[model samples]
Target: MKGLLFCVGLIMNCLFSTVSFAQTQNVSQQDALANTQKQLQINRYKYSTKAPKAIDGNSDFNSMDITSHGGDLAKLLGDNIYKVDSLVVRGTVDDVDFHTLWDASFNGKLSVINMENAEVKNGIIPEDAFWHSEQLNIEDGYITLIHLRRIILPNGIKRIEDAAFSYVVNLEDVNIPSELQYIGPSAFEQCENLKTDPLVFPEGFEKLDEAVFANCTNLTGKVVLPSTIKEIGEAAFWRAKISSINFPEGLEKIGDGAFYGCRLEEVHIPNSCKDLGIFAFKLNKELKEMHLPDGIERIPNNFADCCINLSHVNIPSSVKSIGKEAFQSCWCLNDVELPLGLESIDKDAFQSCYAFGQLVFPATLNFLGEECCTYLTGVKRIYSMASEPPACEVSTLNIGDTPFGGYDSPSTPNDIPVYVPVGAAEKYRKAWGWDYFTNFIETDDFPTAIHNININKPNAQNKVYDLNGSKVANPQKGQIYIINGKKRIFIN
Candidate 1:
């Protein structure tokens, strides 16, 4: 009986040990689950545009008992936004001990960090001595940057010193407090995909440092500039694929190619513009028309070249000069009305414009430069608003063979028609060489001759000449050649 009782006790002991082991395992799993819940439970709150609120100073953070109490979890949970309260000195400055505000993983990455009155504690590290941009930096190669999804910023965190958030690619979003004012350059340079959509700017921000978000190609969506900004630098948004932009009223100058090659269909030039630099819109073929403000004076050469769809344009009266070849190879251009205020026509200004069939001019026009209308051989009418008809070199052709493309007598005949000033036919006969036939039909007595010619569209036909001003071939296939290269012109 004693042996049997001892065996029973041993078996009971073994059962107790097994039961204890199972309970311990279950407890361990429960604790792990609780810890995970605290880490990931996100209260994703965003900053609102409320008025700035300042923090009060009363919490004694470095008390001996609480100093060793681990991360300041109670303080981190006190406010929705996290701002620097007061300096929480840990140990002696020389001890090289560092203290943390929030538990290193306390609120976890789930809560939006509102860093308002929160800052580096004293005794251990002061504000200015610590070049914060160099400190508190991150290094990551991936582009998601989703770590910053729930960060909160309280009002007291006034400034984001340089290099504050360098290369934290996992930072998905940013928390901005109203009290915060300034941001340094390259602060968020490579946060390529910080948000699911493009970032939206908060109001009250006046200045943006250079390259703040440079090379953020995946940051898609429209953004409006805050009116508080006055200047923008070059390559500010270079190679970015933004959709649309609306410039505020206070803008003065646009640094070189400030928004070059963006997919903007149209933009209004306010009166604030005084100058438009060269090639400002070189390859923006999508823009069909632009109306320059009256304040602008000069248009650079090839400023709007390669705009195949830019057909009709009316220069304002304020423009004084248009650069050479400004409208070269613009095949779609049809009608052009020169501004009466124009003073000069540069060489090749309107060359290769075969479509502009007419050029109406005021009597004030005095000069005709080289190749001004070289390829406009399709123009049939040259109407003038001046007191008298403008002179053409063709007057010499009819009066005598000397100016009929150098035909002295044989090629000259009654085939060409000449329009004269009322009774000036007799005078043109003597002074000009077109006095061959006895038919001198007066403009008023047109019915008498019954066969008068309108020099504008001379269906009667004129003698052809070679490049050397000698007759070569008859008119065929839109090309009329003359001997000695007598202006080989394209005829319609």
Candidate 2:
């Protein structure tokens, strides 16, 4: 009887131990499931903004979309990538994928792609059913939105292949089906030659790589530059002819000469510009006016060159240096307010300007380089910014319509117009023996040139071609030859 009872107790203990173990495992599993459910709920709430719409499981669509954030959709994609991956991705038509071939169908803007592997369909992959010889590469990364004028991505796309639209010139129009996000560099380097009309990007384009439209010369018309754009490559719009441009506020670095010779009218220099390259607007004569903001440090050479009709400008107090020959030969330039912070006025910067007068130099100027106002006889009264010209000759010879009618004063033509400061007209007349031109104006207006003295022999060598080949004036250094633009060079 005692042996039987001991055996029963052992059995009961064993049964109880088995039940406890089972209960513990069940509770642990329930807790794990609850945590997982909580995580999934949080993830769903987090990605509520980016979730895709519901669709039938067996729907036949060209492509599928994946969420950027973590959620049920992301989890499902991660779980069944190999199964639904083929349908989401497009296989290259040919085994040897030519990037240009892909880009020629899209207008660059595609870069991320999950192309099919080297799996066989019949004799080849189903996506590789190419009647043409073109191919999509397996190892290559190519993302093309619409290659040239050949391809059109009507259905929404999923991912991009890198460098896919590289150098596809024929691309004319682009209406990226809201699914695209990437664009690579040199994608449309020279595409303006392909289409005669201007190209417009879809509203969704937010990114751009370097040198995208480096030399699209014929790409005319204004474009609202993407606000998201940060950096632009040098000479990106090297020789384009967009009539007017107001760089959309977000652009930071304007790559060296990006719009070097572009036909821009008026540009309001944004504070975003930290460095403006030299000769950036060299020959853009149509750029009539500009307003520079607070941040510019140096005004590089030819920055306002050939802006023939540019009449008014207000140099900001922020400017420290006007680079060498920065505003050379802008003939029609009329008014300029030089800044107080300016330390130097580079050589011949305001040279040959007919209307630029009444300059008030700041007190801080110590280094006014030689020939800063060359051929600018219009300026007789330079209000000294503390330092006067060391030995500047304010004599009659240098205070007239012609600063270069000879240093000894003109023996002929006593009718030359002499303009001087309020009390300085007599100073010039007495110094240079120009008592004949004593009828000068001090405050305003010069003696009108009603009588036109057309010089008979300008070149002297080409006297026969008087009204045809050259100017009729004598070859004087400061005498504007044929109103300047018409070059009267004596071919030596």
Candidate 3:
């Protein structure tokens, strides 16, 4: 009887121990689930006034939104501000709120911001509102804000201060309010993904600040600036992918590198434009033609440098000086007429222009910089209207550094002829850098018209007219023709 009683007690004790172990595990799992649910919870705050009330639930939240009148978002969200991924601010916000939002984007999960219904005080998005701090990762000397993807600006905002959205690489969309009056320097610069097709500015904006859209590679298509735009600041559209742009009639100035490295095919500067900056249109590979207005005095430096496909240009009669490297490496430039009032051609202005078969220098020209006309392998003849040769640079280190130096190779014969005024051949032979030429011919044609024309050989019955409007079937050599009301010469 004693052994039976001991076995029953042992069995009861073992059963009790198993039940206690199971109960402990179930409680532990329930506690773990509750903690996970708390961690995943998201809290939203809506304030009707300037002062915010204490958050009711757990303080930790993954995201938050302030729907109404929040005084300062940073203080309202408190310690949980950095954990937010999406932010929505409506009604009224201040510069401090924008700064806090920028900080969250820089350090935390804040990515999307919606402020379409909100209004910022003073009608401005303050300077450096979204400019990432210098502590983040930088590429090519620019701080790229990779977190923020989208933002909606308030409707009544009038101005966006300097560097407001500069280097926001991942930004995809933003609304430009109609009431906007000014966009400060470096605004929207380097925003590679922001695609504003046919970029149109509001009517009230008068100026495009410096580097406003610089390095925006995806911004393409035609751009029509508003008539109120008076000036385009320096490097405003540098390295953009724009195919064409139209300048307003009242535009006064175009800053340096404003359209450099673009894909412009043609440009027509208006008569009101008085100033053009250096490298304004340089490295434009697709540019084929350009027409300078009558009032521009100087062609800025590197104006059309490396434009290999450029074939024609119209230099106005009022131009006084051609800047350095203005037309360098333009290999296909075959037709150009230098106006009578052109005075100076700067250094390397026409270097490597291989398609110029003939050149006529104006009478007023007095200065020619080093290598101004170097490497012109296709030049057949040159006419100088000036009685005195233009002053050419003489290099001590390289003999082939003058205006017309290296025009003929050592292996190829130096057969190109230079035509001068009736008594100017001896003077050219004695002039600096002009003495290198072996052949000089004097002529009375102070302003001879040399036209490049391709004529199809006519059949025997075709009518051809001479210079005096006389008909001739077979025009002889050195005879000038007036075919189609235009002067033509046949050299057989």
Q: By lDDT, who's the top model here?
A: 3
Off by over 4 Å in 2: 1-185, 192-210, 377-381, 388-492
True-structure RMSD for candidate 2: 24.4
Kindly list the per-residue Cα lDDT of model 3 for residues 1-492, writing each as its tens digit: 111112222433421122221122234323422332222111111111111112444434365667545457787767766667678887788888888887777766577898888988889988868763442322232233446778888879999887688767677777777788898876877676777667777787788876677767777777778888889876688777788888888889887677878888888888888878767788789988887877787887778888888987878878889977889899898746787888999877888898876788998898888777877877777778889999998543356656777444421114577888889999999987787688999987643344666453444554567533468788776545655555566654
Clashes by residue pair, model 3: none
Task: Give Cα-based local distance difference scores for all models.
Answer: 0.40, 0.44, 0.70
lDDT of 1 by residue, 406-469 (tens): 2334222333334444655565455432333224333532111112222221133545553223
Model 3 worst lDDT window (10 residues): 41-50
Instruction: Provide TM-scores for the models.
Output: 0.40, 0.49, 0.75
Best by TM-score: 3
Ranking by lDDT: 3, 2, 1
- Model 2, C-alpha of 329: deviation from truth (Å): 2.8
Q: With candidate 1 superimposed using the best TM-score fit, by how many Å does residue 67's alpha carbon deviate from the native?
A: 14
What overall lDDT, based on C-alpha atoms, would model 1 receive against the true structure?
0.40
Candidate 3 backbone overlaps, count: 0
Off by over 4 Å in 3: 1-66, 75-88, 134-144, 396-400, 407-414, 446-492
Q: Where does the lowest 10-residue lDDT sum fall in candidate 2?
A: 41-50
